[model samples]
Target chain A: MSSFDRNDRPLVDVRHLKQYFNITVGPLRTKALKAVDDVSFSIRSGETLGLVGESGCGKTTVGRSILHLYQPTGGEVEFEGRLIKTKSDINELRKKATMVFQDPYSSLNPRMTVSDIIGEPLDIHKMYANKAERMERILELMDRVGLNSEHASRYAHEFSGGQRQRIGIARALALRPEFIVCDEPVSALDVSIQAQVINMFVELQEQMGLTYLFIAHDILVVRHISDRIAVMYLGKMVELADASVIYDQPLHPYTRSLMSAVPQPDPKVARANKRIVLSGDIPSPLNAPSGCPFRTRCPHAAPCCAEAMPEFKEVESGHFVACHRVNEL
Target chain B: MNKRFTMHIDVDAFLPATDEEKAYMVQMRPSSTFFRDGVKRLLKNKVATVSLIIILIITLSSLIIPAFWPYSYESMLGVRPGKSVDASFNNLSPFEYGETEQARIAAGETVFPHIFGTDSSGRDYFIRVIYGTRISLAVGFFASLIVLIIGMTIGSIAGYCGGKVDLIIMRFVDMIYSLPDMLMVILLATVLKQTLAPVLEGTSLARIGVNIISLFVVFGVLYWVSMSRLIRGQILSLREQEYVLAAKAAGAKGGWIIRKHLLPNCISVVVISTALQIPSAIFTESFLSFVGLGVNAPMPSLGSLASDALNGLSSYPYRMVIPAVVISLIVLSLNLFGDGLRDAFDPKLRT
Candidate 1:
């Protein structure tokens, strides 16, 4: 991994990362729920990799695993030429890598003033020489995030959703991290506010030269900022490619169906767009299919689909798809 | 390719002209902390404000009134060595004068009037009541402090650690809960009074009396269970909040997370619970004293004063009435103040 070219190497290199939770099903019985199973992706320096899936498709889990938020059951994440396996490695990675959580309301501590919330990372890492320097840094962060200096001493509950999200972003940016996993950072806000927050995120990324793994269920929002996009089904990554290629010519059956479900805005285009309605409900992760996790509801499922999970393979420049009938489709 | 939705605009047109406008543009208010905001809300509540005033007045009177008053709570005004019990000084009603005081007034000598008159022992009843208020308030505050310290520590540890530690502590809490509180307190106080009497002989606590020590011991043993359970419930919910997770993500250690995030969020509950606990503790101390298991004689706990008054109830009903009224006033004001604190501080109750 260290042999990779400095300029070309990804800021975050995640390989086969898995996160499983053991939940008790009965009085004495426990089962492993594979929240994130053998998921692999990477984000280059100063690039945004968008991860899109339905609510329970493990998109957030993928983001969290890369940051070592939940200790991975298997596989490894290499951040900036460092294998994040040991506690010290993870702690070091945290200084350079941070997360902007999904819910603004829950992410910022209500009892904490905005200054303390944003200054927490600095305090943890001792980034300042004195109180004055710390306050200056916090004020700088607030300014970058478009928050007023006066907001520095106000509580989280006093802000609206968009402002609270900005505060969360300021805290995430406090350590001057290079990579940030933005886990649905704007999903909890109103649609009008969502666009503003997303624009702010993009602007911040450009100004700071930051890398992002933007996770969301909304493909349109993901496409707006993502340089490349990965589509996940259940706990598996089904497709990955350039953002335009993934939206324009998605290859996997699950990807095709997912693309078709997105509502077209133009009336004429909407009439022509045939929505691929998936027939069955998403199978419980507790009782996932024997082979492909998406086989139960795939429109093009076959006997071979149940025999084994299809390998994710790149069939064209920068376009990867995981499906048995990828060539035929 | 999707066409970019770009519009030519002058960005500076949106910029604020004045510094104040820039500050106000981001929906920012004058900076204040959670405690300050809570206090602001609390001061705005009329009932709570009045209750707080009443509590301050009573507390001030208790502390200061004893210093300048002409009479001592324990001093027998008319009794002297080898003198017969001063019949004229016994059981005078409020503002009434005994024979000596009446004669002094007629002779143009200045005599400090016994405002609440004298008790059967010829001691000034008003001073004793003042002293009793002081003792009760101190006991209530100290007892609640003990409960708060023990409860906060155990509850946060249990709530944060969960699993085995939680189970063990919660079971212990349950065991304490199942015990009959009053009966246990009485039994423990009686037994402890006997055992602690010798141990406390030379210490400064000896002045506090054996029954008072036993009462504190009973409080330490029994009263903390409710506080711990309340705090545990609060911490259990707060520990799972995403802010705690965010704190963890920021590389905050467990203790720091608990101190900076979890505890502050749970402070309103802590404040309200501790406030409510004081009146109950005072009530419990008075009850123990009433049953002869509280502060020893001559200290004049409100309950002891009332109990002594019972023997003279037929002759002077006001004897028992005075202490009873004082006890009710103190308890009522504290309870109302607690309710006010809850209404003011609790975010969940905010409109």
Candidate 2:
């Protein structure tokens, strides 16, 4: 496992991942909820890929699916170029990948001490040799995540919201994994706390050479931290490109609108930019449009857009856009 | 605010100590969180505390006192069967002897050493009542344990694993829930008495074992379905928690996940539910015994004593009142204790 190539490659690679939940409507009737429909992306080693989308756009689903939290309906997950197949393979992959959940208040076990919470992953992995080593590791993790070492003995509910989130981060970092799926880790935190946590994530990634799938609804925050950004709308990845290009050029109309929606601190630039309010609510995944899931809400939809779902193709250097009218646009 | 009032409010609102001071506060955790809450709730429930005290006294006296009855319960004392408590039973002096057959008996009927009085058989009613506590407490303790183990194991497995396992386990639990609990206990007890009793005649311990095991099984299996349902509901909610998912993401296996994450979260529910169910289990056992299906003859459980009292209701009302009061007191205390525990452990109800 150690000899596996680590020079310069994607730390985690997910290709065409799909997660569908079957909902029972009546005695015999059933409906497929395509929570994640053929979503694909990759995170290079030491790079942060921010996944920005609305609540139902399958952002969290993508993170969970990538970690095999929800067994994918169909897809391939490659970790460090090794293909994951069986449960054992997934288990092996999980050792190198972990998720920081959206809700800081609930992510940590309320009954557990900070030591136990952070020590859990190590205990599971059997990373430490003895009790003293385990405690030392836990305290080290606490210090790494900006938590005081003395806080290890205290239960999660005893801590403030910010402290809890830090404890959550410490738990995620316990295994010292190369890649982490941060699913809205700071969204439930206070504004001041969110910055501190986000900065801590950046610092840790640099220090540990970690890759991250940073999922959030806040585009500005994502753009600030991400090397590349992926915009998802209703289970479809509309655009994927460098953070600057995604914000400045934003090839897909949906991406452009989302970028425009971010409130610019400069009042003049903010007022001048037209807010592209999506015409209607996001379509339920059950009855998503036949072609191009986003066509129902895209302001620039055409007849071809309804003909069939467009291929997710690289339209320019490293910029992938999945829309029928990409050529026309 | 006055000092006392401020202290009162502070006591209720006291937060768990911070990590910086946990070393100094370690011993105080249980006292502050569990004992403080338990004592406060117990103090609020006056009836439960009174019954608890009575049970404590009964248990202490029964365990420490001598076995011999100072005066027999079945023997006719000076008091005739229907005589008033203030008159024939209490009127005769302990030192006096009867002159004639009728007056001798009447004078002999004096209270004497018969604190609980005599039953129709003339055995000390008080002594039998004290002895009955051992059986009642045993049934309560063991039967509740069996039910808890079955419920926790089945419920946690069903809930944490979910899908078909949950459906099958829960449906079976529902089926059990539909049956009359007492009816099941009787049917099971009857089958055990007929089939196993004869086989166990060779050994004394075996006989006791068969009796107790059958009794425990009868009540345990009958009552566990509700506990299972409770644990499953708790686990269902607990399984969705982030710690469980985090545990999974950490490569923790399913068994380890259940043991470490799911079980700890639901333990409070199981414990409080178990405490509440003990009295029911004991009551169920007693009811079966009273109806001639329970602990058998010579052992003398509260239910069997009450059974005898029921037979001589008109002749010796004391026979019924003593055991009946003891049984009710034990059940009431257990219920109050369960309530106190529930209030202490249940976060939703806690301030």
Candidate 3:
């Protein structure tokens, strides 16, 4: 984990962010699916904030809301100490930030050549002055992502998944973006390719001094790249800390169960690590438990746990947990 | 830890690959695009190839034969401005000469033989049929193109701007769907033909006549609903593609995304649907002409020609048969070609 100075101002600050999607339960009856509920976090400059959670845990929502791909239902998103309120501000934020999507097969325009795909951002932002400049920028970007100039004329379907992902990454770097929201960018790739992509991401970060809001369900990948990690349950952030601290000492019950569930690579350690298999299925977000989203599955759940949500407070320097039973457990 | 074996390579064996060897190792493929790939697949399909050839032959003859063929579509050979009627020219059988021409042949004067002979009006039947083929093909192609442009534009706009825009456009399409197709086309044709006649009186548009113009209007108004609905469905599914999202995230505008991302992805569906639309347009024009709502008097259309042939049914069945065969050939070949196109271009059906 790379350490950041305590006084370094956060590059992107999200204040009590919330994203709610209203769905009709029946004819004329609507209810809110709180996809991300009042979750707040910040990524310091050049930091990798790996967001790890279960499938429907609003991790991707958190990433998208920061970039305003999905407008937050409530809250403020401040980037580089400026509040993103007006249209021009959002446009500015877009220029400095971009996204790397999951599903490389569907993330690329099949009809366009690889050069056009990588040059799309430059075209959109009007960053280049002339055709030559644009072509130069596109070629430089393609080279940076390890693509041959000869391959630029081919379409997305002609390439393999890892190569297609490289195209996506090259596109993300098109605008010389300072931050990228990589939403499960490598989860759809083969196991061998994942390492190559993750290492490339680390290399890109170091070279370009770029920041990433890395969202994934795969813990090992997150642990490999993340400077700090945030864990979510249902729609709320359960724990946040340095990557090493969260792995060694996961205080929240949900976090503890999540850590215990990761299979150890060594046989002896795997046998020694006890799995805390929680009882019951994951409750639908629409009908989530009233207080403490994890209370329904928490082993130490008291009647008081169902009354109100616990506060996410700092229990130690740079370690935050949202559990009432943090002291005893 | 002690190594049991020392791993080493000879300095002499570490030579870099030669340029030719490197080139062989890379093994690059020649660049190709989706359109080129589709065409390659199309050429490989036997039935499609034959259908395309038939269409080419028919369409070319229709376009070319009218240039040099003797006799006009409207000229009655038996009735001259200042001469007595030559009744033998009327209703002559195929390759048969008129009476005057027969007399000339008896005097050792060569007389041209009538290829398909004359109709009841003593006009050249072969030239009329050729002109009718040209008109029918024109109406079919132009009408289908009109439908395609209007349908594709509205459909993409509605599909890309979902929620209220989609709801309103879809409901309008449903309303159009509910209207009886035949009744609407007939009513529109009648009304438009009457109105366009006067408007076309002093203009260059009068050459094609009011009926054909109204037929195009009818097709534009009525036939595009189905095409639009098809395009809308295609774009609805395609707009959700992640490429569109990536474009949006990069701050590309809606129009840009639609042009660069959405439309190109669904191009195969657009092409196949447009090809299928042509046959129906041709059929609609024929049916309209059959109902006497097609080309005006003296402007031959296949349907009107067939209707005229109905009077001499027993005597000149070949008249009706010729246009009918031509229409059938065009529609069938076009449909087969469309199927071949679907098989060739559709990524889902690539195997």
Candidate 4:
């Protein structure tokens, strides 16, 4: 365990992380699915870093890999200056970094009461001395997640989708974690309740001084909540930058196209903005594009874009982009 | 993120409720028919309910009634053989003393007492058959309980901890299952009786204890193979549930995980298996006894009584009919009861 300086140290620091799954597709044959390949990012203490990409783009894989939920095939993950290398290290890492799942209804056990679910981490980590303190902590978590204290005695299936997600949140918060992985946390929620849950997340972040890697496909949600944003294609990250710069002054052609697609609230502006529609389905990660993954669909693609993989570099302060034709664009 | 967006989201609200309460309310919700209708279908099964009641009553009677009746079939009534006796004295004896009374009467004719008739030894077949119910039911029940324990423990372990252990255990179960049921039960019971008979010969209680222990050993070992197979299939599937993964992530050990999650989830199937096993065990024990491989003479079991009736089938067919009917009824009731319980406990059927 490393000392908590609280001022300079980032809550989580990941470097060149790679996680590949060996899938057996035939007799005595195996193939690697590059689920999370050469990914690098960091979440500062008390800041939210949103990860945005389409389905199957390995956004969720990155979050899971960082948490050591799936063992990384390569690279290093350092939490508060301490490197995670073994099972015990990962177990200890879980105390500071926990995850909330995508499907709220399925994430929680149907058999467990709300209190037990919330107190599970506490029990595992031995966070409380007695039953009374455990009960008190459970009630406090329920209240923090906007659940009434009386609801602790009931099972998860009895609640609505939103309530179940709240219980999931309470569970993630049980260990008093410094960082959390919100894996499409509101994707299974109602559109109306999504705002409430999102607001609650922001409030918790402020109150607890927590850091987060909020993963989702919704650009508007990501832009609103994240201090910085990272975009991915296939299994590789293509862009990383401040949320406003990535949204407003996006340099990567993929980022530009994504931003153009989101409908602005002002109808006049929305009507005026050109929709840059990209063609063709995403290439499978098993046989990804040779160079820039977006080149095949890039409107401004050039011959050099197909020769070699582009290096991810910062063209402006705090704004990173990977493209062979960035100079031309 | 969009604080001003007010899209009317029809939320599916979950209130924390007990399982029973959740089930009832879910039934009342009426959006889906499967959950509520499944429960209704199970409740409508009449034969299953009746069989359950019959079994409960029979079990209670077998346990309770034996304490009050201390009269063994071998006990003599102290009346002179071929001598005319009072009707009351004839009533007290288990067998017919009527031959002497009739002879005296034809010397001056009179009726005598002979309820359910008699064997050549003047032992009461009626009282003996009644007493035999306890032995038959006991063999069925305790043997079935042993089978259930062995089956569930072996099955859950094999299924949950699949690999070399599962392969070895399942092969052993298969080896036992490959033998013919009747032949194997007879062989095992014969071996047990041979070993225990000398030590158990002196007292009635010892004789009864030997019979029970032999029945339990033979049937318990034989029947567990099928039950173990059933529970193994159930646990193999149940261990994959997300709740199991959740428990593991929560740091629960393998034993606690199996005890709290795996066993409770597989209970309905195990229960049905046990119920069905009871009747089959009784039938096997009865068949062994009928073939002269079960408990020996002076201790009447249903099979032994039926065997007696078989020799005098032409003159007194009632002897065979009575015991056979009881055996059939018990097996039928057990099947009905098991089927009913399976339907009721099935989660898919709950409407």
Q: Chain A TM-score per model, please list them.
A: 0.97, 0.96, 0.97, 0.96
lDDT of 2: 0.79
In the range A1-329, model 3's lDDT, one tens digit per residue, is 43433336799998899999999999989999999999988889989989999999898899888988888999999999999888898899989999999899999998899999999999988999999999998899989988888888888988889999999999999999999999999999999999999999988987888888999999889998998999998989999999988888999999889999998989899999999999998799999998899999999998878988898899999898998888988
lDDT value, residue A269 of candidate 4: 97
Docking level of model 4: incorrect
- What would the per-residue lDDT of candidate 4 be over residues B1-351, giving only the tens digit for each residue? 767956675464445667898657644222323335445666688888788788887767666755665444554433457965334333223344555555666786555444555554555556567667777887788888999999888998999999799999999998998999777777777788778777777867575667667878887788888888988999898887756655555445568678877887677777777888888878877887888876657777788889877877887777788888878888889988888877877675556
Query: What are the per-residue Cα lDDT tens digits for candidate 3 across B254-290?
Result: 8998888888888898899888888888888888888
Backbone N/Cα/C clashes per model = 0, 11, 0, 15
Sort all candidates by DockQ, best to worst.
3, 1, 2, 4
B67-148 per-residue lDDT for model 1 (tens digits): 9998999888778789776778888888888787889899999888777888998899999999999999888989898889
- Model 2 lDDT tens row, B1-351: 555633336674478777777856533232133334556776677665675676677667766653555643234454455853323333222243223334646766543355565454434456567667777787788889998998888988998889999999888888898998667777888798778867777877575656666898786677888888888888899888877888888888889988888888777778889888888888887887788776655567899898977876876676677788878878888888777677757777878
Q: Could you give the CAPRI-style class of model 2?
A: acceptable
Question: Residue B105 error for model 3, in Å?
Answer: 5.6
Candidates, DockQ:
0.51, 0.47, 0.66, 0.20
Interface RMSD of each: 1.7, 2.9, 1.1, 4.8
Best by DockQ: 3
Residue ranges of candidate 4 with Cα displaced over 4 Å:
A1-8, A123-130, A291-296, A300-308, A314-317, B1-44, B70-132, B157-229, B292-301
The TM-score of predicted model 2 comes to 0.86
- RMSD value for candidate 1: 5.5
